[model samples]
Target chain A: MIDEKGILFILSGPSGVGKGTVRKALFEQDTNLKYSISMTTRTKREGGEQEGVDYFYRSHEQFEQMIHEKKMLEYAKYVGNYYGTPRQYVDEMIEKGHDVFLEIEVQGALQVKENFPQGVFIFLIPPSLEELKNRIVERGTETEDLIINRLKEARNEIEMMDKYDYVVVNDNIEDAVRKVQSIVQSEHCKRSRVAKQYKALLEVDDK
Target chain B: MIDEKGILFILSGPSGVGKGTVRKALFEQDTNLKYSISMTTRTKREGGEQEGVDYFYRSHEQFEQMIHEKKMLEYAKYVGNYYGTPRQYVDEMIEKGHDVFLEIEVQGALQVKENFPQGVFIFLIPPSLEELKNRIVERGTETEDLIINRLKEARNEIEMMDKYDYVVVNDNIEDAVRKVQSIVQSEHCKRSRVAKQYKALLEVDDK
Candidate 1:
């Protein structure tokens, strides 16, 4: 890594918080951010998923090997398949002075925090629990039982919000993206991150 | 004060760091912010300054009396004149839910930090010391001796930058304003500040 290391933003939120939409809009507005593509053992769907684009699709054996090798940044099993953020790609992008965004669940985000304590942990939330429930219901992508489970999961997720450094309420799409963008820019200006830049600036002789 | 206290931003930097220009621009862009007007023992300049506009021009006796009453948020003497941020005004603004910006010197800033420890401290700076000296020279408001003294003061001021939370380089005015605005917006999203909001949201039963 250069003297100025890039920031790692761990953005985690409960399901149906519009996090994906917010992140997508954020990327559209600010192309400078780099999203760390996660590795998953889940079978890629037939139609449109591309390798290294949607995800780094790994077989169960390969995924297990990575876990054994301790190459996963943070991993979890869901529906009998493994999902995780890879450690190497994050390191590479960060070393190259790119601010890397890791969109993971709360459990995975917390695990990554242990390994990379410097990451900016942001917990996204809906304007209200009612709104969150409404979004999930409107999607109609899951069964009623699954929806109830998701809402229950959301309540638990909300409890752990205090663990993150910042919280962004995704009430308005552009507003939420602007808030995240502001956080990243202000964070770049933090003394812990900008101290070296000042040191180098001070080294220049006043002629 | 309300359950959700307004954020106090303590902004400080060395002379010739363009802090005033940046702050002015910041106010212009974000009208919601409140500038914490200071009380000074020094006489206000005759030509344009207004009472309670530029400063609350206080006589030495009145300033000393306030200090005796522990009314100043933070105070220091420079060139035999007392300058301080009045505690009452800051509290009033914060209670009213206005994000307050207190611009002061390093000594005064550190003092404010002790009393208002929750305030977000931001230190503005030039990209380089050489640039700082150049700006001082370009102003043409001070003599060569004063300019030299200012640069020396800047060097000493910069040494204490690590004590602050964030540092914004005033290389470009618009960029600096955006960074400060971002900091304010993001600070609002901090869990500590938003916890009560969440509590209220949770109180509402989902039908």
Candidate 2:
């Protein structure tokens, strides 16, 4: 076995960028990928998602303790709920050679960038603002005012593209997924990351 | 149409490392890629390859004048023949939105790196030194002494892998080709290159 360390991919985009759909498609294509389940302080409703699968449900006091202990990779308070990625599972998955994908908001993503600078940060976007607005309307799940809010939020998020390492335009879901997958594969071959592998190979004697 | 600027990929490896086969396979897969045609001062043999397609034949004086004018991206003298990549065609191709793949030796690749610092430099290598020597001997195209010399040259080249941006191990030709192609695709999506596109998208006014 190569025992290669798995890459941590931080994926973030605005609300109407179709990031969730693209991420689902990518996971379907690559079995070696593991999605990072976040930790949240929200209440678990009846017949709601599973605890470890969807998220690690935590009490407000516990979440605060985690923050104080510096266990969260990135955290943010949204709508009075504390949401963040815990570092333990991510560390375990990477050690076992499973690439971990963390989907987060821009603020939380930047927080992760500060904590783990080695992670590859990718920002997904629509081809244009007009297309983004159209996608939001086509979803048929939000009110007109909410749609406008999302569009404004997306505009602001797009300005942070320079902070990320790669940008994937979500013009087509399949194409975007393929581009993200390629980025993961190629990042593994970067010289800075694979210098140890090269050294091991070169150290072998030749007769 | 997206007027995307082309990327220059500089590939360097020792002789008999299967760079030619990998490059041929990659070109067959991506029609948008352009194989760089080198300029050589050697005399064209009868029933040989076509001009401008295989190599740009030049007189010694013309080649020296090119050296004087600093027109070569990289050049080296071997067996009294001056072989190099001319800058004019590469510049034109890249300007026309064609990604140029320059396959050269290690020294020439370092020269191109000096000349075109923006190009992505990749060092191709065998999986192991034993495999490298085995492949050299298996080729059956050189004498015993030449094979030994080539193996030594390959060992020296492997030490230079640190100077590259990426490294591709040619354990399997198909896999190596896919890795290189993925590197090319992923590099275009890098934030350093796509930030301008994001800026253009964000500049579109929304009401």
Candidate 3:
């Protein structure tokens, strides 16, 4: 049992690429990963969500106070509500050797990267842009106005992939989840992550 | 199906870490891996070895000429025999999109690193120095004089971890193989490896 520092894996992609779907699938598989639930100022839908499970629902003032106190790892304002990852939980989880997984939007993820650049950033993409458009159309939730805008944003979001460490094509949920799982497993094996432990082992041997 | 360039995975470790055993176990699995047999001038064993499969057995003059012509990827002379990996087969296999696996000694692996630094270098370590010494002793093939020498060399080789990209502790055969497999899969998902292809996808989308 080598007690190494845990890694932070941030899974982010363009809108409507099924980040939530993949994240749920990943967590469903009994893994050692801890899904760090984000705190948001958005109104929780009645009976559809639980406090601190779906999200840590906070009032506008409370969310702003976290920003002022520098307690949020990364937060952004969207659609008149504030959403962010709390720094305390992430730090605590990692210090205890549990990997913290964050599913966030593209902008929020970039902000998190600025603060914690070493986090493994995985960019989830659709199989193709045409398929992406199809998915956007198939969802049917967005009326005429928002579909075009979301599709254009998704196109621009593909360019943001340069900031990621790994890219998983969300062709289907199972394959995408497997790729993410592999990335996490592989990150733990990196020499950069575990070199110090081995070096220390040798030092003990020498003594 | 993304037709991407293959990754080169180099597996090397100290003596008695069972590099050959682990490599064989890995190849036995139904993986897409292609093992690149090393070219050596050393005499093939009485019956257990095959030319081209075990090694591309060659003569001292031919091996030396290959070194002179700079065709050898990495080579080192041991016990009066030249053992080296030929650059030609490695190049051809990689060019054809086959992930080439090379099981080499530490010295030869370092030489290969110098020549082709992009290769994923995995250092297979024994569970512990105590275990390593025990393994060397249990083999019982070495006379008293060679035993001490081999143990000291293995100890020194642990310091070579700095030169490697990942280190897999060879506590058991199956776990070591699994770790190596994950590393290869992760390498495939690397952003640097597939960024060009994704960027080209964006270009196509734009057109």
Q: After superposition on all CA atoms, what RMSD does each candidate show versus the true structure? A: 2.5, 1.7, 2.0
Residue A88 lDDT in candidate 2: 90
Candidate structures ordered by DockQ, highest first: 2, 1, 3
The list of candidate 1 runs beyond 4 A from truth reads A1-3, A42-48, B1-3, B42-49, B78-81
For model 1, how does the per-residue alpha-carbon lDDT over A1-99 read when each residue is reduced to its tens digit? 126667899888998998889888888888778999989999889999998998999999999999999899899999999989899998998898889
**Which tens-of-lDDT digit does each residue in B1-207 have in candidate 3?**
567988889999999999989999999993788888788888889978999898999999999999999998898888999888899988888999999999988988999998899999999988777778789889988887898888789878888999999989889999898888888888988999997797677557755
Q: List the residue pairs that clash in candidate 2.
A: none
Over B56-173, each residue of candidate 2 has an lDDT whose tens digit, in order, gives 9999999999999999999999999999999998999989888999888899998998899999998898887778778888887889999888888887787888889998889998
> Which residues of candidate 2, in runs, are more than 4 Å off?
A205-207, B205-207
Candidate 2 residue lDDT tens string, A27-115: 88888889999999998867978899988999999999999999999998989999999999999999888899988888889899988
Location of the lowest summed lDDT over 10 successive residues in candidate 1 chain B: B198-207
Better of 2 and 3 by TM-score: 2
DockQ values, each candidate: 0.69, 0.76, 0.64
Q: Compared with the true structure, what per-residue lDDT tens digits does model 1 show for residues B1-207? A: 125667899889998888788888888888888999999988879799988889999999999999999899899888999888999998998998888998777888989988888899999988778888889889889999999899888888888888888988888998888888988988887877886677567546554
When candidate 2 is compared with the true two-chain complex, its DockQ is 0.76
Best candidate per DockQ, number? 2
